[model samples]
Target: MSEVLVAFLTGLTTGGLSCLAVQGGLLASSLAQQIEQDVAMQPRPKGAPKIGLRSGLRPRPQIAGPILLFLGAKLVAYTLLGLLLGLLGSMITLTAPLRAALLILIGIFMVGNALRMFNIHPIFRYFSIAPPTFLRRYIRRTANREATWFSPLFLGALTVLIPCGVTQAMMAVAIGTGDALQGAAILFAFTLGASPVFFLVAYLTTQIGARLEAVFMRLVAAVVLILGLVSVDSGLALVGMPSASGMLRQSGSAGQVVDVPVTPQSGTLILNATNSGYSPTLLHAPAGEQLTLNVVTLDTYSCARAFVIPSLAVEQLLPSTGQVAIIIPAQEPGTVMRFTCSMGMYTGQIVFDL
Candidate 1:
């Protein structure tokens, strides 16, 4: 799979997981209990409701199976899309406004989700559909239709229609990628990611209501949320869509960067911003060859000029102030040589032929 596809798929999958953690766990707990009681005459637990981690985690098996299924399916889906398509036929030019917009949007999403963790808005309350009392009360509780899993599948397909803030942010990401088919695939993966827990809950009735479920729930939420906000690195990876690490090494081209000796490369690059920005900003190198970059920034913030190269999928902040040193050795060819500063004010590109 292309690196771009991998990152997008990972992001979409995790985003869905996060959505489920938020909703499948506590978000729907109250409703789940209500639904449980509406059918069964089982009196509410005497003193404290037994809520913990693992037990609560059991509710979304339908989601997990499908999520795992979706991951594989998404790969195949993208393959199908890829087979009918040519190599990506678009420009990879990162601009400042776009980066700032994405960051601000994400930050806003984080802050908004952060706020929602505290309390839901009145407008949101309008759409917060818990099972109605009578729906809960008289729905043939014990004999509830397990065969209707087609329901979540039905709902999951259109899950985007539900107004969730984080999902909106993801929608923006899909749109930004600028591929309709890929976006739909991303959404499908996301739905599967979120549905796992809910379906699991429906499948294993007692497990969800088991004791010690609270701790597991908290852990799941924390882990998934942390994963969802892949930080600026993810943002960079999304924009760069780097095919291989060879793109980071020095090249033999003019007006480009070249590094040697493969010594310790600087961590964060700071470049002074300027107008009429630089091009071929991202530089890559093949294995065992020293690489370097010759950068000149224009028309943007110092941070924007800063070149970032994400390795192992971790975001690496580059210098935004002035020209700096970069080294990448090539071990493979016929892959993306390098992607310059993405998620910044300006961007440059370089393709190593060796």
Candidate 2:
């Protein structure tokens, strides 16, 4: 439940604008058709009273029906895709290394896409995802038809083929769940959260001029860049590599190490996972001794509950408020083991002293 809520919030904040930048064209096209029809249906007289200060009276097109149908179809399509991805994930175990690689690759793509939005380089233009030329021609031809309802519904479903960067990130998360119902629920919650934003922005873009749309796209680009960097950092942490935060911490400490007391025989170390991050970002213990690591969470409802130790291949979803014990094998002197949340948002490490 907590995970789903997080996903929903993510969509509401970032996913909505990012998706609008990618998928708004189709919606604009559909709306253009509706406006033209409405204009043709309502002919203005030469001496008709002016509706606004500048122009004669024009019919206000009914757009609510089309927008609702489009969003409904989009929600259903993504939910089904999530279900399929989860089912496939259950069949094939995604190892920690593979998941990390996927995150890194997706992060790279997002970064490239953002650069393209800023017109950084010609090569970055290739990063844009769009329907093939042939498919686009078909869509354009079909959109010109008289069946207004068919165009919006078809285009809405077609958006699944070209998901935005944020949507793609969510899809990866859905696949990671490895459960059909959970995956479906996650996508459903996220899409539902994004619906209102998508609707309002897309609608306004069609009614307003292109200047405002350009400003909105710039804002979206900035957001995509930030998310891209964060995803890359998370992937680095998952692979036990020193991420940006880790590097900063290391520099701040100036090579100093804090020793944590542990029994010569089997020992126990307590670590707290909080909503913000892990407590005691680093720990030191004696080498060549078995250790029991107790991860405690109290009312933590974030990704921190999904504890992971990439070196040991340990992945456990801790309860909202409870403790989970992880047995660590004795290690040689100077061994360093890194641990992080599943999303790699929160991280810590334990170093064994000589």
Candidate 3:
């Protein structure tokens, strides 16, 4: 539950900039169309001039009504799409290796998009998914006709097909969930989280006649680039490498892998799960002894909560603030055990070198 909340908040903060890049223009156009219609419908006093672009902009709080409808439509559409994706995900069970590969691929795509934002090389063209020309034309036509309800709703629905890289990343997670309810929840929460920013932008532009500044746009681009780097870091973690943030820095100047800390334990081996990752990523245990692995989590909402030990076929979802224990069968000497998160993003190892 807490993990879901984290996902929603993640969308909220990141969507302010990331979603704006993808859906800002369409929303702005819809607002403009709505404002024009509102002004046209107003009865002008005798000898009064028509409202021009620079004319007195009256605040129309009613604009929020249609914008809310638009957001609601988008939330429904994305949630339904997520359900279908989740159903498909269940059909094709994703193994750790495959999931890791997908994360890395998506990460690369995000990085490329970030680079393109700064006029860097377009590295991953195939990942770009643009809505067809017909869809764009339809949206424009609806706006021109001043179909207030339909235009915003339809445009919002269409945005599902033309999402930004951050959205694509979340979609990949949705597919990985493999549960209809979970998938729908994730996407619905994400869309809901993004609504505030979109609504605010529309309100300011249409009702307040505020123009988007170039400086603000540059800041958004910088944020997108940072998100891209974070995505890449997550991908690296899934692939069993060091995080790009240097949380798991390489040991030597040659960039050699750091020695995973190994602790010898008997009976129950207790481990703490932190926000960065599992403490003591490496462990040493006595073989041929009945052992229990106890994971203590305190308010953890990151991917690490979904624990997995692929080699042992053990998968467990830890609570946000509690302890979960796994009974480990006696293992043979010299056995190396690997444990990871659901996506293989956070990993730890247990060595039985007796």
Highest TM-score scorer: 2
Assess every candidate by TM-score. 0.39, 0.78, 0.65
Backbone collisions counted per model: 68, 0, 0
What range of 10 consecutive residues in model 3 has the weakest lDDT sum?
249-258
Stretch of 10 with least lDDT, candidate 2: 50-59
The segments of candidate 2 whose C-alpha lies over 4 angstroms from its true place after superposition are 21-68, 85-90, 162-179, 204-212, 246-266
lDDT for residue 212 in candidate 1, whole number 0-100:
37
Q: Which ten residues in a row have the lowest lDDT in candidate 1?
A: 243-252
Tens-digit per-residue lDDT, 46-143, candidate 3: 87765664455453536887777778878888899778777776676555556566556655655555555555555534334554578667766866
* Model 1 Cα lDDT, one tens digit per residue, 1-354: 232343354445454444443333222432343344333443445674443333332322223333333234333443333322212313333343355346444534443443343344653243233345653444334224543232233233333333233443434334434565665555445444444443443334334544434444444545544543443333444355532222332232344443221223642222233433344334343443445444444334423344554431223333434454454444345445334344332344443433
**What tens digits encode model 2's per-residue C-alpha lDDT throughout 214-293?**
67667767877877787788788988887887666545655554355665565888788898767667877778978899
Q: Quick one: best lDDT, which candidate?
A: 2
RMSD to native, candidate 2:
5.4
TM-score of 3: 0.65
Q: By lDDT, rank the candidates, best first.
A: 2, 3, 1
Candidate 1 regions exceeding 4 Å error are 1-13, 21-38, 41-155, 162-211, 232-354
**Stretches of model 3 off by over 4 angstroms after superposition:** 22-69, 82-94, 97-102, 119-130, 162-182, 201-212, 246-269, 281-294, 298-301, 308-316, 319-340, 343-354
